[model samples]
Target chain A: MATEVLQQDAQAPARAATLYHIENPEVENKAERFLNAFAAVLHFTDYKALLDSYCASSAKCGRCVASCQVYQVSRDPRDIPCYRSNLLLDVYRRHFTVGGWLKAHIGGGWSLTDALVDEMADIFYRCTACRRCTLECPLGIDHGLITRLGRYILSMAGIAPKALQVSVREQLEGETRNTSKLPEPALVDTLEFLAEEMAESLGVKLEFPLDQPDRDYGFFCAVSDYLMEPDTLMGNAAVLYAAGDWDRWTIGSRNFDAINYGLFYSDWHLERIIKRLVGEAKRLRAGTLLIGECGHASRSACQFVPVFAGQDELPVKSFIEYTLECIEDERIHLDPDIVTEKVTYHDPCNIARSGWIVEQPRRILRSFVKDFVEMTPHGRTNYCCGGGGGLVSMDETHEWRMKVAGRVKAEQIRATEAEIVVAPCANCKKQLKELVDYHELPCRVMGLHDLVLRAIDIPGGKSARQRQDEAALAATA
Target chain B: MEHWLELARGPLFAFTFLVMGLGLARHVLLQVHGLVTRKGQRLRQAPWRRIASSTLSWAVPVGHLDRSTLVMTTASFLFHIGAVVVPVFLAAHVALWSGFLGVSLPALGEGAADLLTALTIVCVLVLVAYRLMTPRARALTRASDYGVLGLVLVPFLSGFLAAHPTLNPLPWSWMMLLHILSAELLLLAIPFTKLAHVVLFPFDRLSEVHWQLRPGAGDRVAAALYGEEAHV
Candidate 1:
């Protein structure tokens, strides 16, 4: 029987809907007042000086574009960061120039009005804030940083979409990271159901240790995988367990979700999510923090957590690195016969483009798949699936999301005729699936962990029952 | 002749008075509008020395001014010297201002003023050429750069030609009028372009240097950038 594990929550609580909204009147009012005051005093000198001193110097080189997946896929002129940033650049010129002032008095400031704010809001949100552009830019002018600041500007003007605002608020208040806010009790029930389903399917009893004390490793996975990406989540567990390292690892019941809200709007929100994960790790007494196959989550662990929360000495490892390390240490062994199809690896932006991580995922992929074809623009320069920067959870921007964000990614996948696409990040997985489906591309999306699980050999070789079953299955065939 | 001087006094007073008045108005408009579009909120007091140095350093070049703002300040210093010297030295402009203000300073001879006019022409050309050539300036340079240059150049060039008075009566008067008109255009452009940076640069530089000399400035820059909460 073909077996499939569906979306399951570990335990959900019965409580008020965790969907948050922009409710702080004080913050909102202050933000609005500041923006209005700022607009009134803007001048050409201050504007140009700012560009020359800070922005121009950093964004001077074009190396950061090498990290964008969208540019890799579509090869479109407008998809690049420089072109997109120029849209904002035009507005600055028209309002601040002497000729601009003269033109405005003659009614030429029409473009500087509210309508342009809406367009800016749309364009900035389309970016995933993955920091891929920073890798290519010579001065390290982080495109992600600028994009976040732009989002803040748009939000203050009331030009931001309600869905994103709501999601950001919810995540800020410690709600579930995913759109579907399944509470604690509900998540617990779902985990129980998955335990039974896994037992029946594989004929092996599996124990998912939650809140286990003195665990050496802190196991963190994306909220999306626990709900929507089942194969990837279970495959992660299976790989760990088969290597007999599962006994040393434990998942926390209270804060198992590793989704970083910093990927969305506010620095405050990013800090909130990372702090929760860190607190959980400390509670479990885990020495090493094992990050699952999520790009931004690992980045938050490796980069933002230390910076924002003042945690410097934590051992953070991505799943790819963890898997590779285990393989190198001779802990986890694989049988390559299981995966017969040709595969091409799609490098998630955070892991491939960001400086902290690289190489491990490709090495792991090489081990399992017989033939791994590289995409036209692979690694750091890969395209965003349009689901980054919290757009996947944002419901209102779905149409624009599909049209503008995934347009390049859809083209990139179509160019590659490979049968399977392996993306590590959960959000990337969702974005890729929808983009592929929308474009009517013929390819199956699989996580790197899922491939590893299939190729990983069970402990002590094949059992007597497995040998008998293979013979019996051969006779039937 | 006294009656003629009185008649010209109203025009001179109106033009100079308006130029001085509108300069303040431009500053007010920029401050109010700039605050409206700004996103972040920071309350900072202006630093005195930085302001003084930047004001003093206005003589430095736009590209590099290692203690001496090199090329920019050099050309600008010449430009200002010409502006001050030519008008005070020129027999015609001094005569006009004296008609209104009832005051007179030592006047240069026609030969000396004419030589000063030629020097002013050279400085204006150098400034315009520099704006066009430098890449940093090129990226920032707009049509206004040329327009402002034209405003100053037209008046100076016409005055130079009109001084000889070889042209017919009507053309001579017309050229003089065109020269005055371009000067007015330049005065209007001064508060608007990156030329406005002339006024803003002093305040910005003062604040930057002031902050740099303060205790723990290095730690603050890193902490602010890295999201560390520690106060430097």
Candidate 2:
């Protein structure tokens, strides 16, 4: 029955995926032939020059390998940045160097066989492409970028995991970015439920306006929020309740999810996801488009979203940054009640190095939690949770991911012995949760807002009516 | 001796003129050709880029890149001492020039050039040693980086030799040519290698100015225009 269910869910999406058309029929044939022809001219190409220019101004030091969660978990030499990059580098050498292509196709260049491709694919997939490695490389090589592009090329060869394909297809369709596609009506109901909960809990009457055209702020949630992960939604509710700024933030009925699978595979899909976030904001007439606590979404929103949209500025802030702003403004008074225990913060890889969102969360954690011990290799140099880079959604590698991908993070958590682990990103939460259960660790994992909600002491805070409204919403679930 | 000096002066003057002229021409080509063809070129032309490229980046790296900044500052607090002392006191470089103009300024008495040369040698060695020792620097260390140390060491080694007479004008001229050639090769490699970061100084600062201007207009428009239904 479980296998049948899995097969049905997998096949359903693949069938739908065929309907929404994006064709480069030539991509397969051309790519194959190009690989064959370019095998000869690879030596003559400026690919190495391009790679070197992109890698860094100087030689890239592999100090970041020490911080990689995948490498830490796997303990495989192939997991190292130098090793992984060199694999791609081999392809680059083969296609660009005379001997490399000849050797790849024939026998002597550098062993470019199908097995090598699979190895490269595995190495690339294991990486969250979190950009943590970029920080430690004194030369500033963003190996994640290369790894992401490598995944894209591999997927073109129809070698991507079945689970990743489903999620990507769902995203490509109008379904949720996670494969747990909540229908539009279900999403509307969830918003209503959150609103009622917020009203009852905080006594601040709010409307989560569905499909509102252009408001002050378009609150974009991760697809997980509307689906199985109700805590992300509830935590968001708790934050909005804590803030009591109903007029300022509005959740869009349309364009709900911000999980761009294209972020995992294709530049085009990435662009579309970014656009949807902005368009939702514009549609709502939102002055600012605030995103929830998801690493890739925020990274996309903070960095690539604006870039892809050709916008001169971001219309919104990542929820963490936005929350920080609110706290700084004295909009939400944080009272340290629920979070009295010693706790450490885990910097999500996307936020740390790629997005450079290192300080804001630390400042927030410092303010909310009493004993905020920082994990080793903290800030822009933090390690990945292994469940990043579309791997979290890819169920095929679940066992390896739980065991190997999260090894570094689990070690970090264990070393802290902190009662609570605060990670603002959703994937971090998911990976940390899986690791906690799998490793049988005592620590709890949560979002920034969850901690804030639990700890906030509303001095003359919410009236009875608001408290009742929040209770009603919580009861409905 | 006079005839040989004449031969050295003519080439030095000619090479300096030719190289500097070419450098200027190449700069123009890079700026102009790049300007006309590259899309989104205007975005780079901001004041922030100018200030950042010119000032911030080099300021930090400069101290780390060479120990002479510290040693020279310590010796001549304001950088004025070495500036004034090295060129005016160096006998070979000054005499080589004066050979053409037919005027020789008196050296800064005895032991002065020797003292400055010794200081330069010490600083270069200390700086090279520092780079070799620091982990971050050591990790990035390359044969070429050391090659640069060796290249800089030549002038000091040869100048010291020429001063004492272990090497006469014949070998001195050869040493001087080697120094000039190495320096020239280093210059050409500047724009292409990590050394090109010296050039990035201006461009890096320029990018900072464009930071306020959103480069994501296309992204937002693209996002809005399509993918209303798509969630990923």
Candidate 3:
């Protein structure tokens, strides 16, 4: 008789039922539904090769154990990266491989079941998909990619976190065609308001151009920024004005939202979101897609755009890169003495984990900030703010994100003791802001653009104090 | 018992070696199939120098260490070194390979082989103890993990003892037979198990280079799930 090792833990505590909701009714049981999803995911994705290679080679060396923040906090057996990966890999081995088939026939192996599906639903969501563990694995087993694969398959079964599912559905199929369901008029009004605010505060008229054709750049920001990060949008407006002429960049009224929740869960949703950005870029007649301070959204376009478009139809450049270019080309001069508060940057995992977009932001920061501090392990291998992988959107998992997932990150930030944490990615900013508040750290989180806005030498723009000081100096002379 | 020992050393040894060799080849071929051009997917040209350098870095893995990983990574580096060195270069083992295949490989001297064998045993012990003691390692370990390590250590322990009978507690024939059987079991198991990382390591290290985002796939999957009107 086969011994069922995990069948006992099949009843393992899972918030999956609340988290996962499926509309499909054809499947007989949850196991069958999940297996069907696995087949579908396999059919749709080129992941069989990755799965086969990883299954054969992963040593489960526990080198990743120390790297995983979740494992460190929970100490749960399920949180181990390799062990969690095996939860899905075990199914593939048993069902897809010859040895596993033989073992199953001889009554000596485990199989995918309803309990295991529930367990995966619970555990897969807990991971932030930061890919820090991938950097640590000497064998190059991408545990973060495995988490994504698992999440992708689960999403197929309709067993995904409701927060992500809802947002994706809205972004792909809703009335406004964005995650937050913000209307085009509302976006227009917000940009107008931001421009008016910049004009009032800086004593110069700044343009927030929208739906303008034949522009050099089409800007896409995490839609949530319009609602919550107006300061960041204001900064982007000022910097773009200083960097390029008014006719150069425009925000598409239709596709200004850059946050792709699909990246966190479903590929179908991720691709759909990218397709909209491509369309938006074309609508603006853009030479490039300018992504704002959103981590996963930038990665979705930077990496996936080439994959989906089959050619680099529109070059994707992060706003950080664009700003650095402005600085390099002498188009914009950031006043280094302007920012006196000790400021440090948090590298969002999506942009930096692969060593892309890591250095440009630092160059931009060091150019302007008077007191710049670097986090202990800042670039590429930086810790997730616990709200990554779309946990930031879900109110239900907030406690878990704060207490367990965000713990290490909180410690990292506190150690920096910097007054300002400039998170270039919108997701990191949201998570880090909440993280500091939760941990009661003195640090405040802002988008990199938010800090740069204060220092940017906007054309003909100077504060009243600057004008007053100049007048006083002239009088004294 | 002597006849069994001879068979274990000759045809059975050849069979197990062939199995491992063929299985590893298949793994390499499958990985190549995955890594190379796929029909529906678009493959990006990965930066060749970076990949080469990155794969080399893992071999020595001197970078990417901190307080958290320094001790464990050091043990792993030592363990991998001994794991490869002792099995391939042991003087007694090279003779068998040379006679069977007519391909003579370099051999480690008696003192070197013994020292490496002892090192491998100690590293394996430290690793095993980690699994048994640490909750995370225990969680990560399956039964096969222990089985594989135990399989690897048996030959080193028994062969080391058989060579030095003064230190050997078991009878000579039993030690030789046990060593041969355990070695054969390990060889048969390697191709079919995680020990195949020995060959698959390079493939895993370079997996990122070829990862693609196939166009139309998302639509294909979505339509399949939610029908023709599935995707927006």
Stretches > 4 Å off in candidate 3 = A1-6, A12-28, A463-477, B1-3, B37-41, B47-50, B64-71, B171-174
lDDT by residue for model 1 (A370-477), tens: 878888767765666778877776655556556766777777777878788888888788778877787888888889887776667656444324534665698999
| Model 2, position A380: C-alpha lDDT score | 62
> Per-prediction DockQ, in order?
0.03, 0.09, 0.58
Give the number of the best model, judged by lDDT.
Answer: 3
Q: How do the residues A1-477 of candidate 2 rate in per-residue lDDT, one tens digit apiece?
A: 111222343444332122111223233443453354333222322123334343223333335555566765555655666556655654665565554467567864333444445445556776777766544443444466667656655654544565656665675564443345767788878777876865555555666766655456677767786765565566665566567665566667566777766667655456656776776676667787778888878766766654555653456578888778878988776665446788888888776763357889887778767788888868765777778887787656667777877877788789988988888877788888888999988988887777776555443457333444566698997
> Highest DockQ: which candidate?
3
Q: Sorted by TM-score, highest first, which candidate order results?
A: 3, 2, 1
What interface-residue Cα RMSD does candidate 1 give after superposition? 15.0
Residue A194, candidate 3: C-alpha displacement in angstroms: 1.7
Separate clash counts for every candidate: 53, 45, 1
i-RMSD values for every candidate model: 15.0, 11.6, 3.0
From the highest DockQ down, the ranking of the candidates is 3, 2, 1
What would the TM-scores of all predictions be?
0.58, 0.67, 0.93
Tens digits of per-residue lDDT for model 3 on A1-477? 011445676655553343334334233587887787787777877778878888898898888877888888988777778877887788888877787899888976677787777678777887998978877788888787778878888877767666677677777788898888899889878878887887776678766888888888888889999999888887887777777666688888887789888778777887788888898788678888989888899998887777666553789989888888889999888877668899888888898888888899999998878788988777877888888888888887777888999999899888988999999877888788888888999988999988877777766778434744665698999
